[model samples]
Target: MRLLGIDYGDKYTGLAISDAKPSLAVAKDIVYGKTRQDLSKYMQEIITQEGIDVVVVGMPLGLDGQPTQQTKKTAKFVEWLRTVLSVPVEVMDERMTTGAFRAEHKGSARPQRDDAQAARILLQNYIDRHYDNHR
Candidate 1:
C-alpha cells in the first residue's frame, strides 16, 4: 500500500508518497493555495492521483515538544483531511524538520528540498516506527 506524506504550509502544502513498501517517501509535488473550502478538494486530487492508501501529515511541534499555534492549525487540517480522504490519515511529529532541511540542503534546490525533505523525514519516521524497528 502506498502512503502519502504531507508538509502543510500557509501558502502551499508539500506532498510526498511512499513506495509500495511504504518506504522511500519522495516529494511528488506541491498543492498551491486555494480558498479554505477548496483545500480539501485539492488534497482529494492528490490522494487519488498518487493512489495513496494512507496519509502521513507533518505535525509541527515546538522545540520543547509542546503544540505551537501552527500545530493547532495542522490538527484542524488533519480533522478536515479525514472527511476528504478515503484512506486513513496519520500525523507525524515534524519538529525541526524544515530546519533540518534548510541546514542540509541550501542553494537553488532549497525551496524544493525544504518541503520535500521534511515530508521524507516525517514518512521515514513513520516507516521506522511502523515497520523498520518492528521487523
Candidate 2:
C-alpha cells in the first residue's frame, strides 16, 4: 500500500510518500498554499497520481507531548482532508523531526527543505511503528 505523509505548516506544507512495499518513505515535494482548501486540492492531486492508500499527518506536539496550536490546526486540516479523500488518514507525533534533520545537516549553507525532510521522517516513523507492526 502506498502512503502519503504530510508535515503541515501555516504557509508551506511538506509531503512524502512510501515505497511500493510501503516500507520506506522519501521526500516528494513542498506545497505552498494560502488556505487549507488550496492545500487540500494540491494534496488530492498528489494522492490520485501516487495512488495513495493512506495519509499520515505529522502532529506537532509540545515537548511534554501536549497539543500545540499548530496541532489543532493540523487536526482541522486533516478533518477537512478526510471529508474529501477516500483513504484513511492518521496522525503521528512529530516532535523533533525537524530539529533532528537540521542537526544532521548543520553547518551546511545549502537550502534544505526541512519541511519535506521532516515529512519523510514522519512517514518513516509511522511505517516503522504502525505498518511494520501489522506486517
Per-prediction tally of clashes: 0, 0
Tens-place lDDT per residue, model 1, 21-55, is 76566767766766657766766787788787888
User: In candidate 2, what are the lDDT values of residues 1-135, reduced to their tens digit?
Assistant: 999999999988999999988889999998876577777777788889999999999999999999989989988988888898778899889999898778878888635468999999889888898765465
Judging by TM-score against the true structure, name the best candidate.
2
Least lDDT summed over 10 consecutive residues: which range in candidate 2? 104-113
Candidate 2: residue 37 Cα off by (Å): 1.9
**Deviating ranges (above 4 Å) for candidate 2:** 109-112, 133-135
Task: Itemize residue pairs with steric clashes in candidate 1.
Answer: none
Could you tell me every candidate's TM-score relative to the true structure?
Answer: 0.85, 0.91
C-alpha lDDT of residue 86 in model 1: 82
